[model samples]
Target chain A: MSAVLTPAVRRPLLRRLRPLGNGPLFTVAVLVLGVLVLVAALAPLIAPYDPEALDLRSSLVGSSADHLLGTDQSGRDVLSRLLYGARTGLLGPLLVVGLSTAGGLLLGTVAGWRGGWADAVLSRLMDLVFSVPGLLVAIMFVAVAGPGLTAPVIAMAVAYTPYVGRLVHGLARQEKARPYLESYRVQGWSGWTICVRHLLPNIAPTVLAQSAINFGYALMDLAALSFLGFGVQPPAADWGAMINDGESALQQGATMPALAPSVCIVLAVVAFGIVGEGIADRLARRER
Target chain B: MSGPTGLVVEGLRKGFGGRTVVDGVSFTLPPGGSLGIVGESGCGKTTTARMLVGLERADGGTVHLDGVDRSMRPRGRAGRLERARGIQLVFQDPYVSLDPRIPVGACIEEVRRLHFPLDRADRRHRVAELLDQVGLGEREAAELPRRLSGGQRQRVAIARALAAEPKVLILDEAVAALDVSIQAQILDLLAGIRRASGVAFLFVSHDLAVVRHLTEEVAVLRGGRVVETGPTVRVLTEPQHPYTRLLLDSVPRRGWDPGRIAAGRRAPA
Candidate 1:
């Protein structure tokens, strides 16, 4: 690890990262994510004042130094709420989306690599879930399993496993036809080894591209659930809950709650879309 | 690594639905002897090779080595994967026959890992030996197939096939995809390998002239049947079968030479 930071690897990593620094999309995503994550992770460090420690006299107040982004209906500092709220809005989805994407990558890799009954069984079960509405499935799951960050991640993983799995399955089938893969098979390398050593490296670029798309899909799904009150609960504050809270305030003209969270949602989704498109094009060119 | 071992195929029958692609295909190679199968593309030459190596199953037939009739049955489950430990196939495309991601040495070295499972240093030494046998060196082995020319990749492919140290080697159009100059060079390599290792080779080709350059005996296949089989010159100059004569006639002759129909190689109304 120490040697890795030496001149050779670092130079290439910096060169690739250079493109990222200049790209408008990358800059915006990094900025938004950086602020949100920092404020969330170091709430004690940078938050000017306590979040739950509020002055009711400041209730429903508009932005001031003491109450930037203003105070909510309960007089909780909206800025403070926004900061702490990120810990849920961003953190919850980050957890849920990350877990589900990992799950999807695994199933997709397995289904793609292991054909026959393994593919058939996983494909059909995923089809069963894809047949029904994913959001409806998420709702039913929250109803039965009880709503928490974990439940939605589980629900979303089950709902979207087929999407990633199908992509993986298709990619794996194509990879099996590639000359190099055939070379390994003829070498009489065992099946498991071939899948891991040969197939995994070939399939990685496609799976990762699909995963980025999955991350965006998971974010939108989770926010929608939170909007309907099935996601991370409020009073703890979240982007989706803030959207719900700001509806009446919109009539009253305090728009930051609705505006800010929505902006975060759009930014997260578009970031994933841009990164996925870039990777997908690179992979398509390679395939050609 | 190939040629000390022998291969035998008997009554090898494989089919789709009820249509047999390869039917009753049978042959044997004495240790280090070579057998050439000349066939048009669809006459089941590739399928027979695939079955001999167990890539595809034979519905009914037996593959034997050392007079031990191998799972003397179809290409199906149970026919000599144990046998495959010593049998290798050199496919048509040198480009398609190797994993592009690894260095050429790693590809040959893969067989060493399979049969010997040695540590990295020992494996590298073995691979370097195999590469030298195929007219390559450690420096050549370190490069990837993408970096090499078509002929060189094929040479690497041959090195990889020999890595298994098999007694029998199958060359399925191995030189067919190459240009004539390159093909000639590969033919010379194959001949040298055969002479040195006594590894029996089953060379499959459509070009009789190219086969003429490498093989001792030739079997001409037409529609899954051997139309002519004998010593190479006997089959070529003194062709007994009409199809063999027509096939020889199909070979392009020099300027002002008569076409097969005008030369009695083919009938003219």
Candidate 2:
């Protein structure tokens, strides 16, 4: 398929990425995601103070030039911690989306393209997996594995696989029924090639939008897990962990530290939702 | 021209929920032959056409291409693909048949690349040639299926099928979706290509006019069975089966009045 690649042929794809209407929403979503990713990537360089360094004298201090945003109960720089927190905040969801999308895509395509006994077995397995609520399952796994980053990440990845799998399976089944698959089969294209090259490309936008939506859910779920003390143990800067750490500050009449991370979590989720919606709208328009 | 591969089918049968859709259908087309399977909806023509091209597997029949039983073709990836390339099927709706995401050139190149080991430049050149053969130019090849008209998309689909170098081309209501004038143009194009390549054709259509124009031999199907089989002119002008006569009678006659038809029924009453 790549044998005919030309620079001229790629222009249409680039144009497709730029959403025609709802320009502001798409632009804002992209800008928000870009800023967060840049901040996470540049955390070591841009942070003013060590995220873990303790300043006992400055405990519970409010926002200032020396320690922006304020100091937590542990006297750690809130700004520095928040900036570093962006790393784990983003990485966890990235892991969940990546693993689940891959697993889901594979299983879904198999179930979809080769229906009958295969579809029945895989779909029943998905049903079994989907029956378990993701957050509850993650908590249970985290309990068994002991509280840590690896535990929650694994738990959430497993929990979310069925959701992505079902989406891909349905799309694959629908696409499988189309005449193009028959055409490809008659042309001697392998079933694998048809699923990967042709079927995937058609369903990719929807899958991508699904991934973005999954990202938001994963982000919120991970944050809640950390808040419940099952993810990202203390001494590590995490938005969710920071929010938990700053909870006592709220009782002490110092809400900035906790509120800051809470706001960041909401912003990240909202950004992903906007981006997913934008993609879905663009796909619908393109189909029309 | 290279001599065509003859296709022979016998006792082809298919069923869904114990209801047979194609029951004991059989036919033979010699090298460079064109056969039309004409029927109305649910007549099993499409099922029979699909089975002959390996799109739909037959439960109880043998399909032989060029004296080789299709089932006896090799079983491995390369071998199966090689056998599949010997026959191709073009579907009814060009809009749904071609992938909307890929450009028309890439669609054609996909089939070519699978069967041929040509370099990139040669593949691109061949794609251009195929497009031109179907009455499309270089600019149209760069566009996606959505960018083309119904007729143009069908042309691209035909071009893609031709890229496989098939000995037999099965068109299952392939042109039934196009406008009458566009259908005429596509039929002419098919005739020209057939003359040049000598590929045998199994043309399935509900349109008797199109069947008469594109096929030499006609097989009229009704209720999952072939009711009449003969030359197109013979079957159309002197239909032996009552079902065939009923189908031909359904076609509207020019200058015929509905009031006169009512008057005829009134005369019988």
Maximum-lDDT candidate: 2
lDDT of 2 at A60: 94
Clashes of 1: 11
> Ten consecutive residues with minimal summed lDDT in candidate 1 chain A?
A18-27
What TM-score, computed on C-alpha atoms, does each candidate reach? 0.86, 0.91
Interface RMSD of each: 3.1, 1.2
Q: How far out, in Å, is residue A225 in model 2?
A: 1.4
Model 2 C-alpha lDDT per residue in residues A1-288, reported as the tens digit of each score: 565776568768766666445588787778788899999999999999899998888999988888779899989999999999999999999999999999999999999988999999999999998998888888888878898788888888988899999999999989887997778877877789889888898898899998998899899999999998999988899989888998999999999889999999999999899999888888888778
Return the lDDT, model 2, position A59: 97
**Model 1 chain B: which ten-residue window has the lowest total lDDT?**
B72-81
